[model samples]
Target: MKRIFKLRSELVFSAAISAIIAIIFAIILKEFILGSFLNNSKNTTEYVHDDVIAAIEYQLKNMNINDSNKVQKYMDKENSMLYLISIVHKDGKVIASNNKEIKSIDANEVVDGKKTFKFLNDNRKNLVKITRCDYLKDGCYLYYIYVGYGKLENENIVGIMTGIIFIIIFFLIIWKRISYISEIKSTVRSIAKGNLYERVPLKYKNELRELSEDINYMTSEMEKEDKKRSEFLTNISHDLRTPLTTILGYINMIKNGKYVSKDELNSYVDIMNKKSLYLKNILDDFFQYSKLSSKDIVLEKQKIELNELARQIVQEEEDEFIKNNLTLSINLMQEFIYIYVDPNLFLRAVNNLLSNALKYSKHNTSVEFNISKEKYNNKFYAIISASNIPEEPITDDEIENFFERLYKKDLSRQKEGSGLGLSIVKDIIKLHSGFVKTYKENNRLFFKIYMDIKF
Candidate 1:
């Protein structure tokens, strides 16, 4: 609600500023430009007035009443706009007027001093100036000067109407924007309270639309992460309980003296030890995953030969493959290819991949480890892949989920190992600014890593 009020306040402020500027501009235009034009018009009408008055005076002195045509002709020429002249007697009788509509002059209106009055004629308001001619001392001559000011009045009406229209338009824009921002505020509040499904309505274009899209994207990613975290808890609990239950059961059996022979007792101890070791491995992987997921992780990176690294990791894992009844093969590029990486973390990622191969490979199947150079977009990268035939065929979707935390293949959940191996590998590779992928070709499931090669 406060946000909405703030928006409204800002809009009102802007409108107020605009209105002030418009009013100032109107004042400047009226006082400087329009005032100058009106002044010139008044001056020109005054010149015409003096000339008409001089002609009437000259005629009254020299010509007779029958010779009033000369005065009427002069008045006719001047009466074309805003000038009406008349010759009136003291008894309210008009001898000649340029306007034929003036049948008689009002004797009461014939005053001594110059006086201004409003005159209405032909649906227009005019200013009238009354003058009594002093040349005829018997109060014989009087003139009415009319100047039409209706155009100026119309201009004032237009300016007022324009100001009213501007005010209405500004308010309409403010109302629309306030309504839109209110919608966004409401939706954001709902999302803050954990309603990630709420999304802002996409109205309008450009900047507002992009903001809505970004908010929706952020909410969607948060929802996915929430779901993954829930699943990680559930799966870790189940995996940890399995090994713990096995070790406890063996220990209880030995405590009750249930073994029939001494060899059987030794066998129980061996199985318990193996189960304990499995639990330790799971705990270790969990710790590593936790450390890698933290934001403050630091890496000590150094340049290392990629081919030599792969060969060494594979050789270390060769005996484990043989013990699992699997054959191991290694093919490395003869030319040396070096990449910058943290040796410990990179070794952990490679070890996890090889261990995963041993756990899932079909009996007596050949596990292939290789390092080769590849080019993409004019940049060289070293490709390290470990491939083997799985005991069960893995689908494309399952392959994609392999790098997600606590995700395990349904076929291999009964196998002995933590499901975090591939996830940890993914995290380690991300720290090195590289990527990992899995694909199956020719019945061999392949896990590949791509690292940028720098000289």
Candidate 2:
């Protein structure tokens, strides 16, 4: 049989899978959040810078280059970011200027554009803006604004830490699951090695734990079957060997002329004949058991008077009942109890039950036999019971298991039987779409057969 696959890689793989997904999610979320904030920051900063640039443009358009003092003072006051402005006329005249020198022009390099670069590897920056004067027709002004920032790095670190924490927790849970799974594997391995007693002891419950419980139950049933098989072999060996040995000894004596008298020779032949018959009975039990135990065993169905068959069987065994010092009493319905069944197999089953009842019945005690009809769940049945008043009272537990092959009890008819009688009885009835049950009631041990009566 192919073994069941119970180990799950999904728990371990799910952690790694989800971590990858979480990391991707964090990156996307961080960029979105910070990108929006940076965009808002740019908008706010540009709003103020536009106003300052416009104010400078207005001052240059109306004010003359000669009154540089008023223009410089107004530019200094209007620039909110502390912009340093320097202007050089077309004749190289220092017309309107601030700061120590005209910035980025010692080499007489034409300053034509804005230059923004971070200082000290930090997001803080120096932003330089140069604009030509439309009003002066001579010089251009340079605006230098230094912008400082420090918080973006901290937010990136925070986002990464949040993702890492989530991954760590997920991995820990997966590790715990793996540990339990390994324990279950070990227990399963032990069971495979024929240690049916081992069990997986989970402190808590999960899917694997439930599977463990099922495995434990399977192991218990296997143990029972193994025990029964061993007992069956032992019983079969003893029953076969004893009779064969007796027959062999008698045949050897007759062959060797050890029995000189004709009477002695006849006695030896009779004894051998009886042993041969006994061996035949044992073999028959084995054959019938083998055939009946099959799941696909077929029955020859017929409508038969069930109570009439019961009466005939009782009459046939009447001599043996008397020999055993036991009496038989029957209660049967006057109306016919008809059942659909295999007639020959059903007769064997009934005979097995009678033999069992008589064998264990107390000497001079009455064995009660009954045939009746019953209706249950809209289904009709022919109910037959053969009960023996056992020498010792049979308990409910003993009665329940007595139908099992080779089942043993204290009154213990098992050792005397080939042990297939009751088992054969059970299988035969079940093949007829009926059930056999054993019960103890009113101080009598009963073997109750319920055969379905289909119209």
Q: Once superposed on the true structure, which residue ranges of model 1 sit more than 4 Å away at CA?
A: 1-164, 171-177
lDDT tens digits by residue: candidate 2, 171-200: 776777777779888988998998878887
lDDT of 1: 0.76
TM-score, one value per model: 0.66, 0.65
The true-versus-predicted C-alpha distance at residue 93 of model 1, in Å, is: 14
Candidate 2 structure lDDT: 0.70
TM-score of 2: 0.65
Candidate that would win on lDDT: 1
- The alpha-carbon RMSD values of the candidates against the true structure, listed in the order shown, are 11.8, 11.3
**Alpha carbon lDDT of residue 152, candidate 2?**
49
